[model samples]
Target: MTSPPPHVAVSNYKGGVGKTSLAQGLTVAAAEAGDRVLVIDMDAQGNLTRRLRAPLSPNPDERFGASLADVLQRPAKGEIERILVPCGYGGIYSERISVAPTHFDLELLARTAGQAASERRLLRALAGVTDDFDLVVIDTPPRLFCHLIDIAWTASDVILMPCEGEYEAVEAARRVKERVLEDRHTLNPDLEIAGMVVSRYRSNLTLHKQRAKEMEKIVGAEGICPTRLPELVAFKNMSEKALPIVECGSEGRHMASLYRDVYKWSRDRINTVMKGAA
Candidate 1:
């Protein structure tokens, strides 16, 4: 039997660090590599959901019938499989990638999920689908929703954090380390940081360069990714159109390569760690 797919949570406490961009790119690349991919959009903003055309609704009760909110709030056998909808726009991997889209009610659910059993609810729900995909990428809400973020971290084997090259983003990267330690101690002992990718980088900015160096110190040079995603207009254009970078015009094709490189780098790191464990 094939080994279970790796659950990758592309997370950051700070917003606009290219978290969603990275998640979408990684899932697309994974699918291209012959891995059936599933992207779980845990962010209430539904940015990933909209881009992937997974499913969406402002009304929780109405969307719960086909959104992630239902899987988390009301668990039943086959619920996860039933909610998975295939990608409608990913390049080449459009059919290979699947998504568990989000609903606006996710914000409320995060607030009311209660402390007890908050983390495991997602893990339990995902148990049935572990073998269904080669990779599971979770696009999380930035900062505001801790409970749902915690669930993503708990169920994940590796967390890939995207940090913008700046002081605040660097500080956030440090806090991410602390959160990982806390989770290892109290929640998921197997949880680990796959590595940190410096996104939205501009080569000419001195402060950006300085903070990128600082981030390397925090996660260690080994944990810092070599391929950095440059600040490009293509990202915004692609996002606005609700299309994957790979599917965008030729410019997007070039930009998509950078993101895919990071995914391959991250996948190699995860595989190395899993092999060591075995």
Candidate 2:
């Protein structure tokens, strides 16, 4: 018997913590590792969707087709799968990563989100297609309050917060944990903080090193990922080009390796939790 695919939400209340970038990298890494991955762009900005559609030059303002907002407004079971846009770029994986792209209308979804019948709208939609993939990565908006974030947390098995080694980043991670705990007690008891990744880390800086150590203590050693992702210009360039950092070029190899290691660690963590539950 096969267990349902794990839903991992790459989330942080703080913006510009490289949250979307990390989400994109992890999805690409998972796909290359032979997991059929689905990226759900829950951000109203649509950065994840735009990056994934890059090189193809999608119009950011236009609603190309059915988007996340559309699904949330009328979340019928299996409707999420119908909006999946195939990533045309093929390299490391035999199967291309698929994304449920979002458009500007998602901003509308965020504004009038309370109109939705249930906070579990996303959970119900995803449940219909759990057997189709090994993993589902949700790129949530950078804010803590909102129905969209609620939906993401409700649907997710593990919430991975990618924090930079900075004071604001650390505080943001703490707030996210508090929010998740609130949701767990009141809404979704199954949700867990699988782990937190210290992203864009600089080894030589005392501040960065100290913050990573502190986060490890807060989340426990196992909850903090071993590999620290370095800051790289290639990440931004790859996003602009609509390509995964791993597929960008030789310059991005090192960064990609770090992200891949984190992805593997996350996979192991989820499997361990699932086994314990079994």
Candidate 3:
């Protein structure tokens, strides 16, 4: 008698805060922990999709059959299950993770997402796949006005926001929280913004600490995660190979440990939220 796992979303209104990296790292690490994780790529850029090695790349020679766009517009029984494909990239636990991928076609959903009940489309589509995985992680678009973010927000039980150590990035998190709080009230009452995960942090720098304090103002002392991911040149290079930091051998070990700490924090947050629901 296994209960359905909760859906989690990774998002930020600002771009280039290592949002995709954080998403990829968490998903793979979750699978490494022996949990079956489903990662939904709601971003049109499809960076997570590429990292997971799911088909339907940005430019493919042959057209792939279905994507998140098709499912959102016309959700049917088992449609999400049919759309989900294995993540063949992660060394041993790769098959434990699955992906409901996105592409440029997803941009069409953003323009027309204002239709009645449109925000609930993702929630409706995911209903039939409750027994498929132990947890679901969604990678949302970074733009403020994009409906992909709305779709993920509506469907998620908890969301993780990532921000770089900068004024603009921290401000973006504040603005996004203000907007999504409205969405939660109107759309899904159970959804919550778990906390903010500070990415690309430079502890040796003074200004970065100031930026972190500014973020604390937005999410509060408890709302900010304790473990922060540091900026690494290898992280940039790992993106090319689509490897999670933890599995990249020696060079990635440092950042990998930081990511594991964040993972534990997220797991605790999710548990607390779910227990409250119970």
What TM-score would every model get versus the actual structure? 0.92, 0.91, 0.92
Q: List the residue pairs that clash in candidate 2.
A: none
Clashing pairs in 1: none
Candidate 3 residue spans exceeding 4 A from truth: 57-64
**Predicted candidate 1 versus true structure: per-residue lDDT over 1-278, tens digit per residue:** 77888888888888888899888778777776778888889888888988776765556566777887778875664467778888887455677898888867677676655767767767887876868778889888777337888777778888788999877777877887787886565668888887888889998999888988898787678788899888777878777887777767777898888877887899898887666655
TM-score, prediction 2: 0.91
lDDT, model 1: 0.79
Give lDDT for model 3.
0.81
lDDT of 3 by residue, 31-126 (tens): 777788888999988889888888674445232346887788767655777788788675555679888887877888866776898887888888
The better candidate by lDDT, 2 or 3, is 3
For model 3 the local lDDT of residue 58 reads 45
Q: What Cα-based lDDT does every candidate model obtain?
A: 0.79, 0.80, 0.81
**Model 1 residue 244 CA deviation in Å:** 1.9
Q: Give me candidate 1's TM-score against the actual structure.
A: 0.92
Q: What shift in Å separates residue 44 of candidate 2 from its native position after superposition? A: 1.0
* Candidate 3 residue-wise lDDT at 166: 94
Give the top-scoring candidate (lDDT).
3
